[model samples]
Target chain A: MPDPTSSPTLTVDSAAPNPAPNPAPNEASNETLGRFNFLAVIGRIILAFFQQVGRLSMFTASAVSHCVRPPFFPRQLLGQMVEIGYYSLPVVGLTTIFSGMVLALQSYTGFARFSAEGAVATVVVISITRELGPVLAGLMVAGRVGAAMAAEVGTMRVTEQIDALTTLSTNPMKYLVVPRLVAACLMLPCLVLVGDVIGVYGGYLIGVNKLDFNAASYIQNTWDYLETLDVVSGLVKAAVFGFLIALMGCYMGYNSRGGAQGVGVSVRNAVVSASILILISNYMITELFFAQ
Target chain B: MSASPPKIALSGVKKRFGRKVVLDGIDLEVAPRESVVIIGGSGTGKSVTLKCVLGLLKPDAGSIKVDGEEVVGLGDRARERINTKFGMLFQSAALFDSLTVWENVAFGLIQGHKMARRKAREKAIEKLAQVGLGADVADLSPSELSGGMQKRVGLARAIADDPEIIFFDEPTTGLDPIMADVINDLIVKCVKEVGATALSITHDIASARKIGDRIAMLYHGKLIWVGPAATVLDSGNPYVDQFVHGRADGPIQMELRG
Candidate 1:
């Protein structure tokens, strides 16, 4: 359980030359400076959160707006779809398959004493759809897409390409974030659905070959026990997880403060935060759905 | 518009990060097409001052007006409107490594203006030519070029949009003396050709005199002196004298944390 909130601890040399950025100019009164600092820190924290949310909101809005605009970058969108969605398939697929296999194995040992071995199919399908498919997919995408997004945008930010975009009268949020977010929002459900199928198939293999269950019976039992709500809930969770992963990636990259060190921190923070937020949000969504 | 305004103006602009005050109170103005170079040592609020006017950093106090519109606390739409009129050449010649030379140069034209790729590529090539690069180099990535060439690409990118205001932040910091002079010449020529208002911050006195119509010295978060570039040698300010001479011993002390 890697806590996302844990700050990276590095033993930097005290003598390392800090960018002793000069103090602000004199117009701020002593009173104003005090208030400004207090507010700025609080504002920065709020702003950091807002910048991500705002960027996400603005990105989504602009993307939707662009859907109706004349000069749509369909080529760029297609390229991003490949980069962000299609290319990410193998990693998500493999992780889901393995998770399903392991979950089936673990659940069987626990459920064996109760002689409820038939419940393995139901447990696997329900758990995979409700939690594992979305959560594991979220974490996998965090490691894959989240880090990649952070590094790509983080580099652009530090290198001033983002500023260059600004100078050219382009909204970076619309240009950079929108395509990625759109791709993630649209594709994660597809990925999770694929993941759900693969995961269930994996559970079936383990149940039949390893645990000596009948193959026909396992597949039939998986479908029999799975409600439409279960699959729909996973798809819904996938969409939220997708938004969070892309949001955190864009957020950390957009606000990358320091130079090289800042970019590294951004990548790490993006992946860690997205993964944590996914699980936390998953639990909340689950609680909400089942509470009644 | 009711009478054309000054190109850019900042009056008593102040910004601070925690206990660290980056810009005390910067009051400066750039008339249309004028070139102003700010000279200061490292860690002096030179870059922060530029950032404030660029609307990248909001000031704690004071007014920043570009073409007579107060920009200090403007919203994103307003800020983007102001930003579109400006271009910046960063200290490191921060060209996008992932993009080809032409694509990097044409990024603004394409992404910002939504220009067609063909027209933007043509425009990018034209800009590259202005900076002494050939069409052959346009398709190559920025990383393939040397430091000087990369700086040229940066200069090309800066002017590609033909912005009304251009900022050069330590444009010659890492270049050799000859290369630095070449960059200075390119900057002067390009700024003149574009007839854009130029505001540059640098410690290089030679570069300052070469590229500036006027030179201002920032020390202790204040503009200690601002005058015509020709008169910088005789500014009669000790801090300016110490800085311009690059003396080992001066009022500016190296901070040794206790």
Candidate 2:
């Protein structure tokens, strides 16, 4: 009865305390008797889901608002760009290059059965740009950068460094959350662009050298078949995925509790949520751009 | 400051987390340029009382005033305006790890007051020196420093911009006796030098006696005893007596199976 693709936010922490916090929630587990009401459980789950969405919405709104506000830290923003975008290039490159090569081989074999080998270039170009490029790059960055943001900010939260930031007259949301969100949103599209090219080149390599196709012919077919909307749609997906990744990372990190264990959980949840949101949004954006 | 209004005042301040009532009804005051310390066991709401004043956590009931102005439930901009006059040394020093030592010290000045970086850096170094740290430690990360050195840096940051009010949350918690004494002396020196009103919360009686003009004892969400720091050892209350002496078998019982 539950659709996994419909939920972008993690519901693990959805049962937030209504007022302050009840540290003794474990007491419920002690009641082994007649406390298991199926309807109550369903209602609780539904309410928790709504609460999580509401919290995520509020957190995102504030982070976006802070992005446009003055007193922005140019140094922090630049540092995050280098961390999220520049440092991520090598990994993205490798992934896309391999993916393109695999696509060329797979499409060649499939199209060869029908004597449509010329269609290999078109299939590789469209698939890489419209789906694989942004999705794979987004997933990789989410694992690398999302987990890092969660661990770093979560540690700060537990250690009271965030509280210290407030006392020092700096807004932690502006300083900590805004820069990462802005950098990811700006950087993921660039990474996806690079990925699309490399993936197509990978396909080209297989088609030309390994599959006995003329290099010039392969390049022409690929260039002619690739449309602007295919690439733009993926780039657009990259931006949305980037924002979702950063938002989940920041939201989880800011709310992390306990200590090291809590931080570890936050990091895991951040990556999972970011990755799922990327897949789901990738589908939605594709529909928006290509659906008849 | 003119004996008309206390520098900081709390009347019937209360806070509760779930069923756990942390601060039932705290009523205390610190006069102009005075050092007042609250002593209590762990989880006795000493930090909560200080947090209420700092506007970190809002009390469920009653009023908190700084310089005769009510601050409870104030908006962010207004609260930040009042907080501009205050500095705090957290229990863990809580220095920014991303920054070098001097940058951490100058953070409030550069970010909050919008001071020029060069000027703020100069002032940071100066404050560090006043805390007995040499200029060589300026570029080193805070993680490179020992606990005592970190506490020193925390104190330096607290007094960096010459704030009007300072709060020390367990300033001497993790330090050796000599280092704790060193910090206490620095705190006294800084308070006198800046002419700032000081409010501190600590279980360390030595820290309390050394830095406090007056001391209050909080027990189970209420301040049961309040008096001059000189008479803390002989406060005539069993709870204060138990806490001050670190007696295990007194009115303050440890929550453990015997």
lDDT of 2 by residue, A184-260 (tens): 99999999999899999999888888999999998999899888998999999999999999999999999999999
Error of 2 at B69 (Å): 2.2
What's candidate 1's DockQ score?
A: 0.44
Range of the 10 consecutive residues with the lowest summed lDDT in candidate 1 chain B: B249-258
Model 2 CA deviation exceeding 4 Å by range: A1-32, A35-40, B256-258
lDDT to native, each model: 0.86, 0.91
In candidate 1, which residue ranges exceed 4 Å CA deviation? A1-79, A106-116, A210-213, B1-5, B254-258
Count the clashes in each prediction.
Answer: 13, 0
Q: State the TM-score for model 1.
A: 0.83
lDDT of 1 by residue, A126-242 (tens): 999988998888899889999999998998998777876666666677677777777788889999999999999899889999999999999889989999999999999999998
Candidate 2: chain B TM-score against the reference chain B: 0.97
Worst 10 residues of 2 chain A by lDDT: A11-20
DockQ of each: 0.44, 0.68
